[model samples]
Every structure is written in structure tokens, then in C-alpha cells.
Target: MITIAVDAMGGDYGPQITISGALKCLEMVPDLRLILVGDQEQILPLIPHNLSSFVEVVHTDQWVAMDDKPSKALRGLPNSSMKLAAQCVAEGKADALVSAGNTGALMAISRHVLQTLPGIDRPAIMARLPVREGATYMLDLGANVDCQAEHLYQFAVMGTAFAAANGHVVQPKVALLNVGVESIKGNQQVRLASHQIAQCDALNFIGFVEGNELFSGKADVIVCDGFVGNVALKASESVMRLAVDKIQKRLSVWWLKWLGLFLKPILKGLARELDPTYLNGALLVGLNGIVVKSHGASDEQGFSNAIMQAYREVSNKSNDHFEAIMDQIEF
Candidate 1:
């Protein structure tokens, strides 16, 4: 059985959304067991009747807040739901962790509890980026603000391995994100990382790729420092919001409203692909355990999607492949 430890009081809505999402996950994942870590009094009432076999509640009086500092969370809150969730993974009592809590605190506590995999200095926040064919995986979204060339190279290997293992892509194309595709373009770190990654025979390391090609399916994995990757991700999210709002206003017209009756089906599918809920899980790879971070403000449906993602990784046992790939990295 695949057991997932969930921080039941981590998100903006706390027990209301997290507990609901965990139950939703159980509905879809039959072979799954969830350890909901939070206040027993709070979580017990939220759990549905006659599901004692599937869901186990681990009581914790402390909870991590969104505004809590990473250092403080790690040093102070020993029995917080988030801390217990990570501890579950560390103790091998859970196959993975699902949390919609403070990202910094989660990372900090996860690192302190689970520790990074051998030869790994830090964990990158990697997530699927929707693209032409299906989706591409990008790393260091907001984990490390500044990364060395070697760090970028490590992201490439890990991202490549993750795509191959999880996305089922053999010889996944990996690229370094740059302003231009030219070898000489980009900062010193990008150039150095590109050269090192290209030398790895195990990876299908293509040369530099421009930002415009991020969602063009030009590469299965794109590697960059956290600052650049985070900025790009936020900017794209903003653009998506702007476009969606404008389209909604435009379609609110009388004639357009009539047209929507016929276009609803087609529009719904498009909307699903573009919606943040469809791609809600951001993985913290390179740790010894599986840790998926859901968007803090995600609704039950979105948070449940994140849980499903954890189920997939846990079922696949992707960590073995990821660690093997990390071992292959020279630096």
C-alpha cells in the first residue's frame, strides 16, 4: 500500500480544504493510505464516516503558518503538522508528503528532517510546464535564488531523470534557458552549465534555448537559476491571468454570450489545460523522500490534484531513478 502523509492544517483554508482534498484523493486512489497530520479534534470531525481503514489521523497541536519564517519553523515547531508530515517520510512510515503550507518552512523542515540525497546540496522546486506536445519539466522555480553553474548542471540531470521516470520520455531533451540559443549567449553560469551538461553522454542535452521556446516543446527539461526561473514562471502566470480576464470580459457581450452556448465544450477543454488547478503540484526533488507542494490558495479540487500527483510518483517509486541519475552527475 502506498501511504502518503498529508499536512492537514497547512494551507490557507487549513483543515477545511486539506482534509477535504485528502478524502478526495482516497476516492480516486484505491490502493492509497493517508496519514493526516493535524489536531485530532479538528481533523476527526472533518473525516467522513466509515473510512477508518484508509485514513489515519495523527494529532498535532502546532501548525505552520504562511507567514512563518523558514528558520523559525525548523527550529521551533517540532510537533507541527508540517513537521510531522516530513517526519513520516523520514521514518519510512509514509511513501510521500503532501503539503499546501509555507513553501519556505516546508523546504526547511523537509531538508532538516529528510536530508538531501547523497551528493545533493539543495532541493529545487520543479514543476510541469504545459507545452505543445504535453508538458515540459522546469526546475529551481523558487528554491534557490542564486545557483552556481554546477547547481544548474545538477538540475539538468535531475530534471532529465524525473522526466524519463515520471513523464515516460526516453532520451528526454534537456536545455539550458538562455536569452539566445547561441553558445556564447547568457551569463557565465549558463554557458558553463551548458557545456558541462552537453558533455554528459547519458543525457540528451541539447544546446542553449531561448525563453520564447519554453512552452514550444523545444526541450523536455529546462534548467536555470531560481531567480530567473521564478521570475519567468510568475510573469507567465500573470500573462495568463490577463489574457483570461480579457477574454472573459470580451465574451460577456450579448452576442458573444450566445456564441458561448455553442463554444462551451471547446472552451472548457481549453480552460482546463490553462487552469492552474490542472497543474497544481510543485515537487521538491533531490530530497531522500517525495515532497509535493500544493499552491497555498488552491481549492479542494486543486489540492486533490496535487495529492494525485504524489500518488503517481509514489506508485512509480521515482526516487530510485532520480537518485541513480543524480549519482551519475560528475559534479
Candidate 2:
């Protein structure tokens, strides 16, 4: 059985949604075990007595708020639920750590507690975004806001490794997110990154991808610094929500209303498919163990999927493969 440590107190819904998600996941995967790391008093009551045997609670009074600075919180409260969860993974008690907390806090704790894989300078957060052609895995989603050229190159390598392990085609085409497709269109950093990515042997480094080509199904892995990646992710999410909302509102008139009723289930399915909450979680790549970061507002489904992603990472031994690849890199 693979054990996953979940930060029960991290999200807006607290243990209720977190525990509910775990229960749903348990129903789906029989071999999964969960360590609910939070205030035991709050979490234990939310879980069913029957499931008490399968789910273990790690008591911790400290909670990291959404606004808390990652470094200070991790240093001041060594036993914060998030910190403990990462520690559990580091100590071999849990195979992975999943949290719907502050992204900075998760990255900080993972780095301080779990440590990075050898040859990895810093960890990057990545997510698989649904595109018109197929899903594309994007890296540095928000881990390192200010990154160097070498860091972007490492993100490409990590994103490639993740895509391959998660079933993307061999030697997935990797592209650097840029203002334009032209090689000379971007800033100094992007130009440097472009050169470095082209030189890397481990990745099938494609050239720049302009904002317009993001959803064009041209690349399998998109690499960028966290600032650009985060902005792009947020913009995409807002656009999706606005579009869905408008469609639903427009469908609420006369005969169109009946179509809305008939398409309700389909709409719900589509919403679920495109929901940012569904993709709220991100993988902390370059770590020795699997650690996923979820949105602070994530609900049960988001948390559950995060757990499933962790399971996939552990089962695939992505970290081990990534480390091996890094060792083979010339730099």
C-alpha cells in the first residue's frame, strides 16, 4: 500500500472536504492509505469511525495561513501540518505529501524538509493543462518566480521527465513560453534560455511558443519562469470560468432553457473537465519524494486528484528517473 500524507487543514473547507475526498479516493483505489496531518480533534471527527483504521491522524496545532510567508512559517513552526506532512514523506512514513495550502509555503517546506534531488538547484511546480490537441504539461507554474536561464533549462528537463513518465510521447517536444515565435523576439533571459534548451540533449527542445500558440497543440511541454507561467495559468483559468458562466447564463432563456436542462449533465461534465479546481494541484518537481501543491480554495475533488497524482508519481518512480537523467546531464 502506498501511504500519502494530506494536509487536512490547508484548504478553505478544512478537514470536511479533505476527508470526503480521501474517502472518495479510498473507494476508487483499495491499496491507498492516507495520513491526515492536522489537528486530530478536528480531522478525526470528520472521518467515519469505520475508516479510522485505514486513515491515520498526525496531531499538529500549527497551521500555515494562506498569507503566511513560506520561509518564516516553516522556520517558526517546525510542526505545522504542512511541514509534518513533508517530514512524513522524508522520513519514509509516507510516499508523498499533498496539500491545498499556500504554494510558497509548500515549496518552502518541501525544499527545507524533503530536500532536492542531486544536481537539481531548485524545485519547480508543474501542471498538465488541457489543450485543443491534447494535454500539455507546463513547468515552473509558480515555484520560482525569478528564475535564471539554467533554471528554465532544468524545468524543461523536469517537465520532459514528468510528461514521459505520465505517458506523454517519448522525447516530447519542449518549448519555451515567449512573447513571439521568432527566436529573437524575447528578452535577454529568454534568448539565453533558448540557447541553453537547444543545447540540452535530454530534451527534444523546440523553439519559442508565443502567447497565441499556447493552445495550438504545437508542444508537449511548455517551460517558463514561474512569473510568466503563473500569469498565463491564471489568465487561462479566468477566461474559462467567464466563458462557461456566459454560456450557462445565455442558455437560461425560453426554449434555450430546455436545452440547458437537457445539457445540464453534459455541462457539468465539461465544467468538471475544465475547472481550475480540477487542475488546482501542482507537482513539486526536483524533490526526492513526490509532493503536490493544491490551490487554497480547492474542494474535495481537487484534493482527491492531487492524491491520485501523487500515487502516479510514486508508482512511476519519477524522481528516481529524473535524478538519473540529471546525473547524465553535462552541466
Candidate 3:
């Protein structure tokens, strides 16, 4: 059985949505067990009696707010639901952890509690995005805002490993997010990182990829600094929402209203496909165990998907496989 530690009180909807999502996951996956970390009073009542057998609640009095600084929050509120969830994984009580709290706090707590994998300098948050062709994985979403060339190389290595384990492709094409495709078009850091990545024998280095080419499906893994990656992620989400909203508005005319009603389901399907939350959660790569970071605004469906993602990581032993690949790479 795969055990996932979930932050029951972490998201906007609190334990209600989180518990609902976990219950949904229980229905979807038979072997899944959840260790729900939060106040028992708040979480227990929300969980159904039938699900009581599948879920074990770990009580905590405190909760981490969305705006709290990760470092200070983790230090001050050591018993926060987010921290305890991570601690569960660190203590071997759980196979993986899923949380929809402050992104920085999740990353910090995971690093402080779980530490990095051997040979990894920093752990990166990698998210999978649905593009025109298919899903593409982007790394360092908000883990390391500023990174060294070696860090970028490590992100590429880890991202590729994740893509492989997720069955994207063996030796997935890895690219650095830059201003242009040319090797000489990026900043000094990217240029240096590009050189280092090209020298990595274990990776399928595909050279630099610009933001425009990200959805083009030319590469399987795209790596960037946290600042750029976060901006890209947020921008993509905003644009998708705007486009969808505009389409719905334009189709609201009397004549087009029927068409709009007919297309609503199709559009919703597309939106769900593109939504980052539906894609499970971002993996905090380089950790000893898998740790997935979900959006703070995520609903139960999103949380459920994240739990499924944790199950996949544990069952596949992605961390061990990643370590093996990193060891073989000639850095």
C-alpha cells in the first residue's frame, strides 16, 4: 500500500476540500492510504466513516497562512500541518507527502526535514504543463529563484529522470529556457550552463529553448531559474483563463448562446487539461522521498490528483532511479 501524507488544513478550502479529494482518490485507487495531518476536530468530521479505515489523521493545532514566509513559518510553527506532513515522510511513516500551502514553506520544510538527495545541491519544484502536443515538464518553478550553472544542470538531470519515470521517453530531450534558440543568445549563466549540460553524457541535451518554443513540444524537459519559471507559469495560467473567458463571452450572444452551451463542456475539459492543479502537483525534486507541491487555491480534485502523483513516485521508486542516473552522469 502507498501511504501519502496530506496537509489537511493547508489550502484555501481547508480540510473539507482536502478530505473530499482524498476520499475521491480512495475510490479511484484501491491501495492508497492517506495520513491526513491537521486538527482532528476540523478534519475528522469532514471525513466519511467508510474512509476512516483508509485515512489516519495526525492532529496539529496550527495552520500555515498563504502569505507566511516559509523560513519563519517553519521555524516558528513547527507543528503546522504543512510541516507535520513533511515530517511524516521524513520519519518513514509515509511514502510521500502532498501539500497545498505556501510554496516557499513547502520547499523549505521539505529541504530542512527530508534534505536533498545525494549529489544534489538544491531541490527544484518541477511542474508538468499541458501543451498543444502533450504534457511538458518545467523545473525550478519556485524552488530556487537564483541558481548556479551547476544547479541548472542538476535540474535538467532531475527533470529528465522524472519524465522518464513518468514514461514520457527514455533519455528525454532537455533544454534550458533562454531568450533564443542559439547557443550564444542567452546570458552568461545560461551560456555556461548550456556548455555544462552539453558535456553531460547521460542527458539528451537539446540545446537552448526560448519561451515561445516551450509549447512547441520540441523538448520534453525545459529548465529555468525559479524567477523565470514562476513568471512563465503564472503568465501561462492567466493567459489561458483570459482566452477561455473571452471565448465564452463572445459565444454568449443569442444566436451563439446555444453553441456556447454546447461548447462549455468541451472548453471545460480543455481548461482542466491545461490547469496545473489537474496535472497533480509539482515535484520537489532531489529529496530522499517524493514531495509534491500543490497550488494554495487547489480544490479537493487537485489534492486527490496530487496524492495519486505521490503514489506514482513511490511505486516507481523515482528518487532511487534518479540517484542512479545522476551517479552515472559525468559532470
lDDT of each: 0.86, 0.83, 0.85
lDDT, candidate 1, equals 0.86
Q: Between the candidate structures 1 and 2, which one is better when assessed by TM-score?
A: 2
Q: For candidate 3, report its TM-score.
A: 0.95
Query: What is the C-alpha lDDT profile of model 3 across 180-271, one tens digit per residue?
Result: 98767988888999999898788899999889977788889999999999888888777877888999999988999999999888877777
lDDT of 3: 0.85
List runs of model 1 lying over 4 Å from the truth.
261-272, 275-278
Comparison by lDDT, 1 against 2, better one: 1
Score every model by TM-score. Answer: 0.93, 0.94, 0.95
lDDT of 1 at 194: 85
Q: What's the true lDDT of residue 175 in model 2?
A: 97
Q: Please identify model 2 stretches exceeding 4 Å from their true place.
A: none
In candidate 2, list every pair of residues with a backbone clash. none
Q: Could you tell me how far off, in angstroms, the CA of residue 315 lies in candidate 1 after the best superposition?
A: 0.9
